[model samples]
Target chain A: MLKKPRNGNSAQHKYPHVGRTVSLASLSAHLGLSKASISRVLNGAPAARSIPQVTQDRILAAAQALNYRPNLLARSLRRGQSMTVGVLVPELSEGYATLVLAGLEETLSAAGYAMMLVTHHHQEAKLTDLHRIVMERAVDGIVAVDTSLPVIHSTPTVTISCPDPHDGVTNILLDHDRAAELALSHLYALGHRQIAIIKGQPFSSDTDIRWRSIQIAATRLGLSLHPKLVVQMKENLATDEPGFLAAQRLLATGIAFTAIFAFNDVSAIGAIRALQAARRQVPEHVSVVGFDDVTLAAYHRPALTTVRQPLRHMGALAAQSLLHSFTSGGNHEASHSVVVEPLFVLRNSTAQSPALSLQC
Target chain B: MLKKPRNGNSAQHKYPHVGRTVSLASLSAHLGLSKASISRVLNGAPAARSIPQVTQDRILAAAQALNYRPNLLARSLRRGQSMTVGVLVPELSEGYATLVLAGLEETLSAAGYAMMLVTHHHQEAKLTDLHRIVMERAVDGIVAVDTSLPVIHSTPTVTISCPDPHDGVTNILLDHDRAAELALSHLYALGHRQIAIIKGQPFSSDTDIRWRSIQIAATRLGLSLHPKLVVQMKENLATDEPGFLAAQRLLATGIAFTAIFAFNDVSAIGAIRALQAARRQVPEHVSVVGFDDVTLAAYHRPALTTVRQPLRHMGALAAQSLLHSFTSGGNHEASHSVVVEPLFVLRNSTAQSPALSLQC
Candidate 1:
């Protein structure tokens, strides 16, 4: 039951000047009524006990002058569902992550879901805590954007990897094999048969599937996949020194390749550096292509022509799938994979294979 | 009773090594035991029925050789706590966010907290859904990273922008103003008076704090500040078009300034591009400095010398704060801000103002 309006009919006192003014706060203060009480009456908080007719009239008049609105959070709590979805990312400060997250956020928000973001770079260290957040039904569902997941769980998870799915988990992936294919095929079509691939790294614990796919694709391409061309980087972070070093080794081997496809854009950039240092003009002496088409790709000196992944679209789909599963009540056991394709982004970085050393 | 050894006093002739060498599946097949039952006994799961002494021996023998472990989820659930945190970000598929996240991941993993990341870029739309996820208590705590928040809650929030400590939130900021001071001072010391600044769009949301700081510092240094030096940008993504346009405008202004302080590494790179296009040699014709030292800043043709923020460290620290408060059982109510200072990294991007072309 709502409490009776304080000070009986004081609020109803005819204004000293008709319709001149009396702010809600002033009226409440003079009548000794709590702001909460005034707020409730104005916003129509559902309670049975009615305010005196005169007090109600006065409150309405005062509210008209003040033009106050109820707190969004308070109003939302009563609506049965908050239109917000908590987006948990390992980190948003990075470029690649930001792009994908941006895509997801744009789609979700347009559809009317607010994204509440929380980043725990220490999800492994505090699995118990993370699990509580994911499993206890706090969020409608979860999207685990862990590139190198040190851990996976039995809860409803949407994984971004190379096509591995679980019962309650949905996997969305940009086909690594196809991405590699796109790069390799482009170089092959440039009328060059000898192409070198510098694998990024083998240290990503969750990258076994990608490595495996590359191996298979290389075999199918019929290119003599030299173990040497597969220069595996042990370092996780891309460094110019190693890139130069790798290039030096590749050049010294006299492989006679006109194009180099580094695993990712950074590596490709590094390879370009090596090519420049060796006095090899890009697309003239050698052509290079990269993967991921990150923001830096376009901004780079020659601009990178590479493969594009629908990272943002994929992010949106992940959210949509989760929301669908969530709103449907029971588990949508059709757990499967959403594979995004990579498109070759033509840019200054690549050109038709240069006239092979005519001396050959 | 330790369930007396199954074959008590029967160490006679059946001392076969087969039992010890048996695989889990083999043992299960031999004993006709349910895989679940076998797993439970092997993993030390509490089972309803007491294992007969004979069955126990077989299970123990099979376990000792195979080295089976218990399901982590089941074990963690039993313990009633998870050591995980929910991290929410705008996205993780971008460079800056990824790099910073990498740093955070390294630190957080070292300390033992798994990061479960979620991505949400739409600012105004999905907030309600976000609230539900938080209220439902998905993870132990949350880290909001690189997300441009439209509205902040009283919840434990750590903002990326310039956070006012008065708001009772933890904000980690790179001393943009101080870094500007350091860059300008270095240039001043180098015997150059004329300067320019390539401002970032949203370089300062409400007011350009960095610009203001630069003005104040320059004024103190007795160096005249030019209004032309202050270029403002207001956009969401770093599309490079706006940056390029601004640089063109600055160049057209024709006021010869020795150094340009870009708000971020991307803008600085853009400034360099414009300088190059205009045939101005970097550091020779104009010495350039940028802020938010990004990965490309290092590989940038003229390695960029800019301010480096402890981005990853800040992420880890944010996670640590959440864990610290969570386990503290609600006593550490002190919502304080943690500010990480930026460092001036000198590189090939800057040089003494080129000997002014004496128009003699």
Candidate 2:
């Protein structure tokens, strides 16, 4: 229990509730200046440059003395810009969406835009309602993350890892082919021939593309993926429970494999737990590779060997693109895709296959 | 790369740019009614109930036909309520803050409140500026998470895990005493006497209280924590790097310890890794206990035996309390602390001490 206030800063007392009572008209009357000139000077409008410096200074001095905090709602109404961006995510969790949100918040805040966050919980009806709510709130733009946007709207929009490309929405995506190649090549070089795979939940936007890219990469490397060794996540959960269950199913198949390529870092951690529970030591009997080297990947026991997606960078890119479209006069028609490459991070979780070592 | 739009439903076309062109005056003229009557009816104002249901239905039908969308800025200015809450966090990461934010977002969204999120990044100047910005934006309430709040203003405020207690601000905190009791008792019952401990970063709000509670619990249990066996985390990182380093420092002290109580789950995982590197097999040679059973804790390699701090519930409590103050006419002077209990999760990482078994 807290006993006393830790920070007793007096700075907040400078701006009190008096600002709510002071109006622009009162300040204009006190300074004997026209309301238009006072408004222009206070708003820093382009036309304010022509106003005499002495008059502007006097108005500003009086406004400050009166603690005249301009109501943002009124100012936004006058300028026709709310200076807010709506961000849509499936849900807020530790992994992908949170990292991207951190990046988006930094960029948007630097540009003086507040983010109005809404989670759809991966429900179609909820997504529709959220879109309507944000639109009704009159956000200047929207950034949809890992959610299929409904349709083209008048507002400028940007999507991060969204598979659906709307007519006017810019898409920021990871190069799944490069990601697959990096993860698969490392495993292949380690001589992991019999590999088990954990696929992402069906609702995830990256599941299909990432799986397809992995299959392509495997075929190119002259490796075949056995149907029995592949397990798909059935539930949309924030925890690693689904991955743990999937790994158990893979083990139940009574098949032998040298390694597992999990859908993400959390799942990889789960798969490793399952292997340990089954008395299969990682990197000694099985080599596990994970994707999305999230914050936990590096610190995970056995330090996950994974493919890194710059999640925060992707979020920043979405924010920047949406802000850019606004500054460029809403040129939504120039919609295009920006692809970012992935990096392969080799850590302790993976190594030379046990079978290969025995053979050698 | 995305090639085409996925959902081509024509729902969005119903509300187009025509809303920008149509005005209440135009609708008033079209209906041959006064602008005041039309506005009242359209806004569903209390006075509109006096009007006939037929007339209200007619007004609504016409507004829908005209695709009239009210400008929220002007509406908010008229009502003097923005229906928005400002959420302040140190930074957005996967573990503590993200889980709390997810809960806050869910409860606030259900109550029709938009969240304007800002991260202070643990800077005094930035926190002050963010306070001013959110106030200027006229947010209905404020929720500060794991950050020391400034002096209270007229705004209704609630804090999640913030150490500071200000007038008119409610604090939602974890019951650290019970948490310490649960963890220490569990460790003591396992016959662990020589235990190493990892302290949280000094900047964390819960660090001091959690440490004090642990010390009290240790004294009550007749277990003495050796000075050389304890190490404190110095960095405010989201990863387990700090924990790993702390554990290595403990190891370097050459003190014989059979178990470690880490500051959090990530650090516990980090300590486990460090122990493994030093050839100490968990539960076989050393046991590890963690706090804040995060999403990855159950799936951790050793399945972290941790203290569960119901983070999402804490966040929901903050939102619900803040909203309650608003509906209750801002009775913030009744600001009180809400203490939530922690759960002790028994998992794979902990076991009876090896020294005890050796003696037996």
Candidate 3:
């Protein structure tokens, strides 16, 4: 039922003389109504239905006339639920975290929940302090993105791309095994036998599992994993400098490889730059495949062929799961993990191997 | 001088018997101290120094032992000030807003403040609702990024990249005039006579002023901005598609131009893709310069030569100004605007103009 005004303008125009400082007590006094009766009507409590229609209308009219804005903080204090969630990310400048955050924010906002965001910058001490702060502020739940949070608490929690499993916390993860098979099978079908790999930074939660998946996939394809052909990204940089350096190191090894599978799109772009600098044209000499088809992948010069992780969708799923848990009264038995699939995106970066064509 | 334990482990180990539900009253009862005395000591109020060291130590020890966690929300309600700031941005996936948010979070977190982030998604109705939600949540202040908020309110507010001048809001802006001069002057010194320009999307706050500055800069350089050579981006996409489409439109005009100045790095990349598809090599047939040296700019295929806006620093400055306003009791008179300079970044995308060299 359209009981309230359609827009704020009509209410303000009709009550132009109402002051901003009007309180519930003053409104009750002016209407000659009990404070409890007025509160029940204004809050739309179940008991408000028992009140006569005329009295309810009178209470609503008086509230509109007095311009009594409810103090959400004080009300939340009495209710013991802040209706806010805390989000912790490693950093916000990168593509992965930001994309996930965008999806998370969209869903949370639609559900009428505010988000308190804090970046720990991958510092354990800072994470602990921020967690304490958010908990002190009394958020109803928490969403940790690409962060390791081991402590179990009463707050409903969801973790995205977080490898660590904790009791009473739900995890949103990507299908790393399928991701590996998709990338390796594509490269193998392209007639590339000698392939180099770039591993993610050690600090990344996905690094260990992703590398393990890659090794298993390579073995299943009957491809020998050469130590000299693999290099790991050493720095925790937001830019592609680490990838550029890793590719440079691969070239310096004087090893021959027709294809390079990079850790992410940013690093793939960097590796291509290093290949170009070394006079090896992309696809013409060294075909590169990247992971996580970030927004830049499609616009890149060679148009990076990548494995898409559906990052934003994963973020939205995390938010929905967290909200669901709130309604289910912390029922952690239903699901512990939600795994999302990865798809291979074919772009301009990959082509038939130079060596295979030469053999033909 | 260290009143608290260095780490959470020591306190937990020393107080393992304490229950998690302990409160201030329970701690006072356990220690036979008054609630006022315990609160003053725990909160470090000015009157705490007047209490004897023995009594203060007793209060701290018992509070820690009892696991008394002060409810920040309840305390904030009593103090009438929540140490939380509200941040509104158009979207979170883009580089500009995310970078600024990173800087803002760093500064705000360091000052023991939490941030409530909401994305309006460029919808006026959603923005209005979100604004009301954040305000009702009782944030101490607000920071709006690239958003138009003209409403005059009692809350302390700071805006970044907002062109609209509100009566009581402080604006953190990039010097668009200098930005135009930096890009145009660089192209002019390179002897580019016929240059095409890509204007930002209309929804962008910097689009109008930036285009105006470009026109003024072009006139100062004695260069004519032909309508055929100027194209404005139409779509509000997060990728480089709009820039690519704009560049394609420019090419379809069949006008001869030796250089192109794009709105941003993302669009510049798209424009480069379009030019490459048309067989015009970057810096060979045409020199292309981008704006806002995003993280990808340094790693782009041609390594975009662009203008840097220092977005992160601008975000940090906005946060500091908002904090300063709170400390100064909302003194908006001191500074209405904070203008930041732009720098010209030289890279491989731009070089000596092809037409000028041909003429020579």
TM-score leader? 3
Encode model 3's per-residue lDDT on A1-360: one tens digit a residue.
001223456675675543244567778889998889988999899999899999999989888876666777777777778889999999986689889998898898889888999988787898888888888888889999988884756678999988777877889999999999999999999999999999998878888889999999999999877799999999878887898999999999998999999999999988998999999999989999999988778767788999999999998999999899888867657439999999999999999999988998
Q: Candidate 3 lDDT, tens digit per residue, B1-360?
A: 001223456776675543244668778778888888889999999989899999888888887776567888778877778899999999986678988998999899889888999988777887787887887787889999988874645678889988787877889998989999888889999999899999988878888889999999999999998889999999978888999999999999999998999999999998998999999999888889999888778767788999999999998999999899888867658439999999989999998888787888
Note the Cα lDDT for every prediction shown: 0.62, 0.85, 0.86
Better of 2 and 3 by lDDT: 3
Q: lDDT per residue, candidate 1, A1-360, as tens digits?
A: 011133464543553333222344565776577666676677676751476767766777766665433332333323424455545555444345566667666666566565544455434554344444443322334566644444444334566552345566677887778877777777777765667777655543324565566667667777666666667655544454555666777888876778887766767788898899889988787888877787767767678888887777788888777667556643547767878787889888887777544635
- The pairs that clash in candidate 2 are none
DockQ of each: 0.10, 0.36, 0.34
Compute the interface RMSD for candidate 2. 7.7
Q: Would you estimate the TM-scores of all the predictions? A: 0.66, 0.87, 0.90
Q: What digit string (tens of lDDT, one per residue) describes model 2 on residues A270-312?
A: 8888988999999898899998988778767788999999999
| lDDT minimum window of 10 residues, candidate 1 chain B | B1-10
Candidate 2 residue lDDT tens string, B269-346: 888888899999997898899999887787567778999999999999999998898889775476689999999999
| Candidate 3 residue pairs in clash (backbone atoms < 3 Å) | none
Candidate 2 chain B, poorest ten consecutive residues by summed lDDT: B1-10
What does the lDDT read for residue B109 in candidate 3? 87
